[model samples]
Target: MDIWKNIIIDKHFWAFYYYCKRLGDKIWFQKLDDNRANLYLIKNGK
Candidate 1:
C-alpha cells in the first residue's frame, strides 16, 4: 500500500511538472500575435 501510494504521488508530481514546463514553453518560446496575447492576458486576469 505504501509503495502504491508513493507511485501515485510521483506520477502526479511528474504530470504537474510536465504541464508547467509545456505551458512555460508556450508562453516564452512561441511568438504571440496581438489577438492571442490579448486573449491570454484577459484569460489570466493580467
Candidate 2:
C-alpha cells in the first residue's frame, strides 16, 4: 500500500488532480503490473 500512498502524495499527482478538477474529469490512476499506471478520466456522475 506504500506505493499507492506514494502516488497520492506525489506533487505531480496533485497537479494533475487539480488540472482534471478544473476540466471536470474524475481522475483515477490504476496500477498495471509493477512499473506502469493507467490514467482514467471520467466525466462527472458517471
lDDT of each: 0.35, 0.54
Q: Can you tell me which runs of candidate 1 are displaced by over 4 Å?
A: 1-9, 25-46
Candidate whose lDDT is highest: 2
lDDT of 1 by residue, 1-46 (tens): 2322323234544554455565644332222334343111101112
- Lowest lDDT sum, 10 consecutive residues, model 2, at 1-10
Candidate 1 residue pairs that clash: none
lDDT of 2 by residue, 2-22 (tens): 344444455666666666677
Task: Return the lDDT, model 1, position 28.
Answer: 23
Residue 35 of model 1 has an lDDT of 30
Error of 2 at 5 (Å): 5.9
Query: Any runs in candidate 2 off by more than 4 Å, and if so which?
Result: 1-7, 27-34, 40-46
